[model samples]
Target chain A: MTSADQVPFDDRGLAYGDGVFETVLLRDGVPLLWPYHRARLLRGCRVLGLEPPDDAALAATWQAPASGLEVLKIILTRGSGGRGYALPESPAPRLLSRRTPFAPAASRWQGVDVCLCTLRLARQPALAGIKHLNRLENVLARQEWQRADIAEGLLADSDGNLVEATAMNVFWLADGVFRTPPLDACGVAGTLRAALLEQGVVGEAPLSVETLLDSELIEQLFVGNSVQGVWPVNTLTTPDGEPLRRFSPTSASPLQAAAHRLLGYVPLSGPSLSGEKR
Target chain B: MTSADQVPFDDRGLAYGDGVFETVLLRDGVPLLWPYHRARLLRGCRVLGLEPPDDAALAATWQAPASGLEVLKIILTRGSGGRGYALPESPAPRLLSRRTPFAPAASRWQGVDVCLCTLRLARQPALAGIKHLNRLENVLARQEWQRADIAEGLLADSDGNLVEATAMNVFWLADGVFRTPPLDACGVAGTLRAALLEQGVVGEAPLSVETLLDSELIEQLFVGNSVQGVWPVNTLTTPDGEPLRRFSPTSASPLQAAAHRLLGYVPLSGPSLSGEKR
Candidate 1:
């Protein structure tokens, strides 16, 4: 069925969030960093005990838009007909694809303000790192802010460790080393975050709000995901919009530039790369 | 739309588990403990920031089967259209209803075997008690066993405090008092459990697996939900199927009988009740 087709009412994804999804960046007619997305999707299927999608079906679904930058969301649910949370003996997994127009503002790449969310994520190690459909925690965190200027909200696990943004992975340059939170306990391991880690551009480290607000230690901060490359954190604020700290919106750091390159993001003006301009 | 109809592709419920649901037990043409279910559903809507379903619409959806006991599942989603987790400008919530035949064996009312799931639920107090759709933990916990004989799987929070069964709230008679685990940390506050608490038949208390296995302190164990009424726990086993403890199966205790009465469950042959026979 096409992406616009209605899903069965009894689908477990709608009932119990029994599904996983991937948001891929499609520039022009090509999907960026698809291998990583595919791997994560497979891992999610394995974790949820769902059968992997057929290669041909997945390829057909990933057909990118003819042109322009867009967001392609792929949702794979354990298809309908299971008794409550119980799995069906012979499962038919449904794959849905939808593409939406996306135009990231050029100014956002330079810097964006973020706020700390009051809703702390639960430490669910079993469901962590997989982009499953059970995203009520993120929904609640996103609801904490309503300002048009606030680009995202940062979340922490119940233990007070800084985890991730509502829709992105977080990274900071501290003591001349780039680091991000480890996702062993909670947080979605974004594809962009994985690429940075794989390229040895970012290291995993436990961070807290105290460490993040410490201007003396943290030199720079940024948030990123597969859909939107990386947006430098210009200022950090509390849920009440009280400014906690402000980082200068300087030129992209060497590590941030590296991350941008890995994500196939070419800055609008600064550096030259072989890709479509934003 | 009827339950057999398809849900729209963009439904937030399918996309992000942004919804809540209620399972009402319908005996003949009457819904048992509906007020409790309605209150919980509205509470869930408030917790998730969704518009509550219209009373008339809800009443129409809850039309019970003509005869016999059946499960009436009502799902209320935050409707379609949202930019990621951001709230829609004007929300249009969707309410869906479905019914399935339910036939709980009379023997189960006497006693049933249960097992401990290795999966520990993450403690998220913000989403605790309200039965929203983010239930991957329950799905994973249910996957811990495939044996049909194991009626339910008991779960504990990461802190080692017993929470609830995968699909039912748990209670035990300890020192001549009925107590259940508090849902402030995690676990769904079931409708039947609410009824028992409201009726002053059961109290909330922290419970541990060790305490449950203790034969001297714990006199009897039982599990209940809106759908299945109550079933006595005859045996508790480890994930590996090793017998942890066994309690003698006697006729329904006073608390059990009270819970049954509150749930409008009438035993097939035991005590007389002013309700349709199961």
Candidate 2:
């Protein structure tokens, strides 16, 4: 928050939002799941025309860092390009490492109530899946809800295909199969989502909003990000505040317990809300 | 460009590309088409949920002391909000006024060569026309060509709709009618494009790439922005460098003359390349 941490006026990340970033959760001074994050950051660099980072330099930087339950972040920018959108011939990509307290709302750990955002994510294959700096869509989606009880916003594409929660990957259980929307056209392929999928804990399904509204087939809903691991969803509502579905935390849900065990974490839980119980 | 001119590291504009900007072409120390650019900037503010700028303060600031034939830019951002995408409860919007030298590549003023960009503009109706900071698509498209000869890159939507050049609005004299793409789904509605349209010098048309590629019907091509007023396109090529069409600059083209007269500028001409003689 100090003035010393400011970026230059011509910084491309500021002017054109030309950059990529990674949010790493630190536990005992070690960045959790760093390999996956590093890989994604590197891929973002190549795709955005920024020179890839040096692994040795990055490893030394990551290892040499200091204390507390802080959230560690790395931002890579194609430096300043003034007002233009074109990349400079010799771009000096700025590699910034910043540390901030990992103090997200405590309520986030105890499940969340999400509303379907009116603003749908644009299908951009070129920018999809990478943690790039252009995140106005998330901001717009999050802006839709202001109540403390509503923790996150769920987004879909223009075609009504389910995308993700504002900052987390979303999944639902339907007929005992964990169904998560494919993010090839849009949405971030979140690290936690990747880990769960790689561990054979979840499967991809093309779930549209209409399909998700069918409460009969769906069993459970959960959303997750690295910062919060995974949290069960308590309810889903339409934009006009109509409750489409309500989910209660249950130890009996095999996927819920399985996800926690596989990720070596506990699923976030809150008091059950009213809905047609399974 | 200096250390003093830098922005905060946590600037929502930098962290999330949560900002909007306007470029005003300055001639003889006065910004050309200020009203139009100012209108667009205010509209961007309303759309992005930032407080509207004080008109009196803005007018006073604009009338304050300044010099040079430079490009005047105004950047409005909802300050820094740390790592989150949510707007701060009490947002402090930063208004930046900067002047950069008006020295674009000389080749830009003359009839320029363009090629189809491999990247497609993702159709986000939420962000179609207004120039927000999330411009990775334009950066990626402009990166498609490194040749000094290629002045700009033409972009299309996922459905083969011709959007616009990477940095300018485009219009073509098709079948004796001035036709330009309707920017409903994507593309920045450049200030010059608006002026020309408002003046009845051009008409909106839903142009697809196939329509533009049909060279027989189109008589002339022009691309423009506030920084560089309208300039004709001399050649067009596919992304893979196969020649799609070659346009000739002719004094005989009435619409070309009309655009120049309407904009109060002369059409830039370079040594004619191999094309039909005028």
Candidate 3:
């Protein structure tokens, strides 16, 4: 509950990033998409050969005397054991959860400017899709801009393959089909994207920047994550700040309509800015 | 300083590994090779766009009541603000320094065994050679073995280019010359390795496992870091506990001898096992 009680200098999570974390939106003391976060956390544990902890207990401990709207962040680490990278004999998982209260963030990606980050994401299939803590690539990419005008920066894999934004998964509509980049290479498969795919609203495809920018068949672009749902993307800019291309929903995109119509709780149109508040 | 007064859950270092750390071996209340760690820490800050903290003040605080044979660990994070990957405006660097009492480790790789990890390191030139906190690769590689017989695990890049052991830079004595893997792609450039290079004891060369095993021109193999100087590698094995090759110093390795004799304080021939203690 307090800073001193949460972490220590010997924490393997801080020492070697031997951990995974999930940020779930809390609606009246309940974490939305609890199942997905729990699954991902367990998968991360399996990858690092750590035992899974009871996250339900952790959520309860975090939401005691909870408020209306807050973010419940659950971090499961290899605990304060292990000499270097090798897991300690009989390793127990360390669970650190917190609640940061905030107003519900509104969707405001329509007509926003995004730049292609000069920095590329390294291809690490071992760490791909499971949200582990070794996130220097995302950190460095997000640091590429501090302007109030830029909404986000698109990142590409080492082979110039379009991956995702720094903090969100990307989706684009083309030929009346909804396509998103496959997370087989390197990108966190966010819960919103998974939900969209499972509900027959979005499909997976290998996306390249060239194909997205050059194809006239592309109709609309959007990005989203579990915490912040879908928001339509409009503009793409080069690293030089030159306008690369502009896109909009040419027609009433069935996918967008289905996304909002099917997932009623997901906000699609609202006024908000990008930063800590969002 | 104790866990009661150390890192918080909201610290970016724990949340994102958005920080850098230095593990300097303390000799009787003195941090050895202080300059290299300082330079690397500052350089890491630059790469992450974090302002350099006054490490001198941190050192003073750490050594105020220092004792014999310990490791002084310093962590500099883009302190507790910011949401997601973006750096907070006018960020202040948070400094966390701790004295971990440790007995000086000695090199015992004369007839030791090391495994070649199946997990390959991804090439990230931007983060290559910097001791950033994003170390999932090393953690995964190290988890390949738990047996006391295994000394360390060798890691190669995705392209099969030999990079380093889990925590040390490797030096190979082949063709009657000293050569080390080019760390322009992946692997941490440790201070001891850098010092050996600066002292004209090691040179850069791209090595592959095939070359090291097949070519009879190869002779001695050694690995090192600041805390543990030069360790002579003996046998190599595959990840599934299969023998790849058995090797020893074909003759007296000049590199190893110089690492000990030339550098007065480097404990080269001492009998200290590698693991969390080292």
Candidate 4:
């Protein structure tokens, strides 16, 4: 889209990353987990001090994809015309959407190799959890690896606490309990992560890289998000290509299966592919 | 301007804040401190892994204001079409500019009131010092106060180290030495701050709000940015409207005068109004 056809140059979202976004998965032209997405978008608006559009207005902005699995990315900005950091009195919030085709990889569903990123997420309790646009950290972390085999890179906070993957929330089975890092410090509280937490499939905990690398303590690991379903982590490697931990990719773990079911993801070929049942 | 007339909705600047910007002061259509602004923009591009536009291409984007003291804000984004955090291999950067009328407040030059923000800046060395688009911290801090008299707000890092003002760099005279906080951890490394440091007029040091509030140690305080020049902070107040420290606003300090001289600011009335001497 041309500049005139899209966001204005003076937009606060373009100027200061003063906005929040939601990436929703579309199944046969219907948005999956839309209620969760809407809730998170409203929460983000509250955190950023922007007056959110009402449910009717918000729902009007969504457009059904042509067909099949697609990604519907919605961005809500504080709108244009703010004096530097000072916000305008009555901000005219703008909602923008983009739809892109999504093709899920079967290998990712079975298992995928991940790497440890060198970049650490800054602890900003105010902006944490909400998927605001200040995502240079994630961009930098994602740039750490270029190998096709490395599906994702995990990030940690400045305090060395494992936060999440570059684009997804991470969870691991420890002592027969599925736990993920708390987003109280820093990390995007993924919609998928929240759904799993609500379903009592996972719990929050302080996860450390050192502790997670010990396979004996935590063997089952996976990463997930709203648009992309859960991907079981088969191998974990450092930025320098040193192997940290490895898991058997014999089959999708019970947690992964549960997440896939919740996400409405249908495995290409597997006995435990029960997402269609939902 | 319409969205098509300005930044595209898909522009990475709006999508992920994957960009850097510079605000320059203009006098009679001539940009002040153009070199410093250019250098910092280039530095920001490097930090964000964005390919810097050529000098000619960069200069082509600047549109001289109608006349007088106007603000020219130039934003260079990593263009559009990046899959989430993953950048496009051959990225196309976009240069956008906005010109606005700037009226200097005579009282701000004399002395202005500032507040201690409850919102703390997140320490991210990777994004620190560069005037990148991820400025939600500044936006949040600026929202902490609404009084017209309060011209700015001072921010501290999570570690309680005084970083900078909402939109300006702060400096104080402590132990007969002029010092500002180092931008190694957080805060924007402003062009004026760099110019002052380069001219040997100011030095860098870690400052604490507690230490700064102690009048005996730090009596002279000021805040500055490229567009507004130097503003002598007359009083510091808490968010609850409680006075923390008050300084004599009889006249501008020598440091402020020096900074004004470098910034090409002509005061309304003052004995040491020597910005025109240059």
Candidate 5:
């Protein structure tokens, strides 16, 4: 979309990160897991005390013709709140949908090499568990890795609880069960993770770094968001002495197997990076 | 400035709150407190690891010839950092400026009423002190007060220490001395606060809520920022059972006296609202 169709400069998203956003993958111009994305964004608006966008308008914004695997991003912000942080008397949320060039298929399937980030996410229950625009924490964490070899970085809360990857959620297969960190305290509630939990593909609770490292029964590890699907972890390490390990769902755990099967696709190495155009 | 001269849709500031901004008031088309605003923005960019913008280019963007009083805002973002949080290698920073109608003289001095916000600021040393756009805390705090009677709200850090108002840095005369909350923990390093400190007009330290209520020495309260020079607080109250009181800074406190003389302004009042154009 051109700049004219976008939100105004005074939009609250730019002023205070007072908004929620969703990234949905468009397959043949149809957004995958859109309902889940919508549900999450709506819930986030409730938490932030702003009205969710009109469903029909949102759907119209999503209608498009996709040439390949296109990435559609929806940003819903509490529209112009005057000059300060205060929400206006009549809040009108701004919604914008935009697309980017497709991603490499390999980065989604073959888990990308990741390092533990030095930056820590602060616990802000007021803003926790929402895909809000206040993402300096993620931005700081992702800045940890500059090398092309590293595709992502894992993040932890201030208390050292393994929270998530910079842009994705983290899940581990331990004792044949899928486990990921709970979002009741901090971190965004990833749409994919919620879907997995509803389908009994993963269990939610705080995952400590020590617990993950000490688990000899660990079989498979993967990180993903709704739009990116899942990527198996081949090795994980950091310059700060975090241990590295390889894992796979196909040969290791039934939970991982179930997750892959439920996603309605055969597992592959890395994301479909540079794959044939769909 | 016209809308065309403003930031575009893809601008990272509107996308991720991925920028820092400074708002200065222009009197007679000459922006006041330019040095203070410029310095704070510079420090914020350094904290966020962004390249410094060319001062000449930035000064040129301040060319809007709005008459009388206006608000000149400078937005500095880390250029277009793409979809992910990782900063693009060797990327130039985006620096844009705009002038808008502002400073209804009546709103500046007669002093504005404020509420004690229910929302609390989260502590993050990595992102604290500097105004880097991750201001959901301020947004939430501002939302706590909607009554036209209350023009602003005061925010406290998660630890219950008085931080600042939703938009301005706070100062109080306690025990015949001017005291303000330290920004080293969790508050924006406001340009006005920096200017005041440079002039030795205020001292910074942790000002707990308990201390505010317990200190009988408090004479008057004021909040200041780059845009609003100084607005005195007439009343301060909290729903959480904190005893509230009003003091006369003009009569008792030397610091307040000096501030009044230096700022050379009275604050906004109910009557002033009608005479001034917003």
Candidate 6:
């Protein structure tokens, strides 16, 4: 949208990352995960002491069909607070919704490779897991490696504990157990992770570099975020050492099969890297 | 200025705080600290990897005499970047200049009460000290204390060491030494702090809460930011302890005197219990 059609510069989002944002994928004009997205958005608003945006109005704007896959962005800014950090006694939040075209499949779904980034996530229990705007760390982490060939990076906390990728939550399968790092201290609690947890699909625990080195179980792996539903990890490496013994998902792994089924990916969509037909 | 007359939303400044900005106080249409502000603005651009704005063109717009104290703002966004944080392989930054009537200075400037906020400045050595747009900490800190009577809050790093006020650098006179926390590890290297340091009017040292209390040398105190210059501290208290002693400048303290001169205040602006002069 043009600047004229947008909110003022005083927008708290621009001023301070003083807001929460969500990017939902819209397929043929239908928002894929409305309830989950709205719940998180409202939860974020509560965290920042902001008024919730009108749900009906937001849903209406995204209801119109658009060709291919589109991204519906919801930016909730704490409107404007005079010139300081404190929330206004009464806050009138600014909620903005806009949609833009995005690559429908491979860029997000078809699975992308990732590198382990050197930047460590800071520990901020209060702000942890929320999609708040203070994202310089993510920006810096993403900038660490800029080759078009490498799609994204897996970042760890300062203590060498696995956090998540720059823009996605990570999952690793070892010994037939689906595991993801607990978000109790840091990292965002991804909607997909929450869904998987509720469905008893994956378990949360502290995953560390050494744990990966010691674990023998590996059937498949992937990272997930709200915008990018899930992308398989084709290869993983770090300067320290190669942690995984073999780095490809088993063609017949139940978890992978279940994930594909749940995400609506048919076998004809793509074959495994080993040229095995799914 | 209203949002309509200016730059676009895609401007990187709003997107990533991927820009440099300056807030110069204008009196009778003339910017009071133009040179310092300009220098810092340029320095900020350099750090953010953006070219300096065109100063000649910027000056042209400020030619008109404005009424009352005006706030002149200059934002140099990395013009625009496409969907990512990597500086455009090659970038041309956008420059936006605006002027707003000075928001009424809090009457409590002399001795405004302050809360010790919960937010802590993250240690990002690379981005620390520059007033780039990644200000979520400040936004969060300011949001913590909204009592109209409390001027601002003093913030600490995650380690509970003093950093600065929500929008300004802080100083305390302890044991007759004019001291402020070092900014190398975390905190903004404010323009005012730079000036004070360069003039050798204030001593730079690591200040801890323990040191602040034990020294007990405070006779007067204040916080400094570009927009409002130096504001005297009235009461400095955190939940951890009783109110700290206040310090006022005298013939012996060139630093406080210099600050007073710089801010155009007569010697020793008395402390205000609520930060208001009255």
Docking quality (DockQ) for each candidate? 0.81, 0.75, 0.69, 0.77, 0.58, 0.43
The most accurate candidate by lDDT is 1
- The segments of candidate 5 whose C-alpha lies over 4 angstroms from its true place after superposition are A1-4, A65-68, A101-104, A213-220, A239-264, A268-278, B1-4, B63-67, B89-92, B104-112, B217-219, B239-253, B260-278
Q: Residues A1-278, candidate 4: write the lDDT tens digits.
A: 11123777777888899989899888777888888898898899899998887777666555543778888778888888777789987688878777778876655776778999989999999998998998889888988988878989999999989999999999988888999999998999998899899999999989787787764878688888877788888789986677888975535566777777876875335646533332
Report the error of model 5 at residue B33, Å: 2.4
Which stretch of 10 consecutive residues in model 6 chain B shows the poorest summed lDDT?
B269-278
- Tens digit of per-residue lDDT, candidate 5, span A154-268: 8888788999988889888777678899876678888778878998878986777666666677676777776666767766777343557545533323443455454444544
lDDT of each residue in A1-278, candidate 6, tens digit only: 11123556566666666777777877778776567778787887777777777766667668785777777877767776565565666677766667888663444344555677777787767777777766777766776776555666788886789888877788887767888888755677776677677778788878886665455555466777655556677666552333333366434444445554444444334444444323
lDDT of 3 at B103: 60
lDDT of 3: 0.74
Could you tell me which residue pairs clash in candidate 1? none
**Over the stretch B1-278, how does candidate 2's per-residue lDDT look in tens digits?**
11125677777888888989888776656767778888888888877888767876455435655665577777778886633887886777777777766754434445677888989999988878998999899888887876767777899999999899999998888767887899989999988788778978789988778878885787788777777666678889865566888876743344445554544455434345223232
DockQ of 3: 0.69
lDDT per model vs. reference: 0.83, 0.75, 0.74, 0.81, 0.70, 0.66
The candidate scoring highest on DockQ is 1
The residue pairs found clashing in candidate 2 are none
lDDT of 3 by residue, B1-278 (tens): 11123567877788889889888877778777777778888778787877777745656645666567777788777777687787776576667777778763443534457788889999999898889998999988887877677778889899989999998888887767888888988898887777778888888999887787677677777776777566677777776667887775422356766665533454333333233233
Which ranges in model 6 have alpha carbons more than 4 Å from their true place?
A1-5, A105-112, A209-221, A237-246, A249-263, A267-278, B1-9, B33-35, B57-68, B84-92, B103-109, B213-220, B238-254, B268-278
TM-score-sorted candidate list, best first: 1, 4, 3, 2, 5, 6
Runs of candidate 2 exceeding 4 Å displacement? A1-4, A56-68, A103-110, A251-278, B1-4, B56-68, B103-110, B251-278
- Please report the candidate that would top TM-score against the real structure: 1
* TM-score of each model, paired residue for residue: 0.94, 0.90, 0.91, 0.94, 0.87, 0.85
Q: Compose the digit string of candidate 4's lDDT tens values, residues B215-264.
A: 48786888888877788877899866678889765355677777677767
Model 6 chain A scores worst on lDDT over the 10 consecutive residues at: A237-246
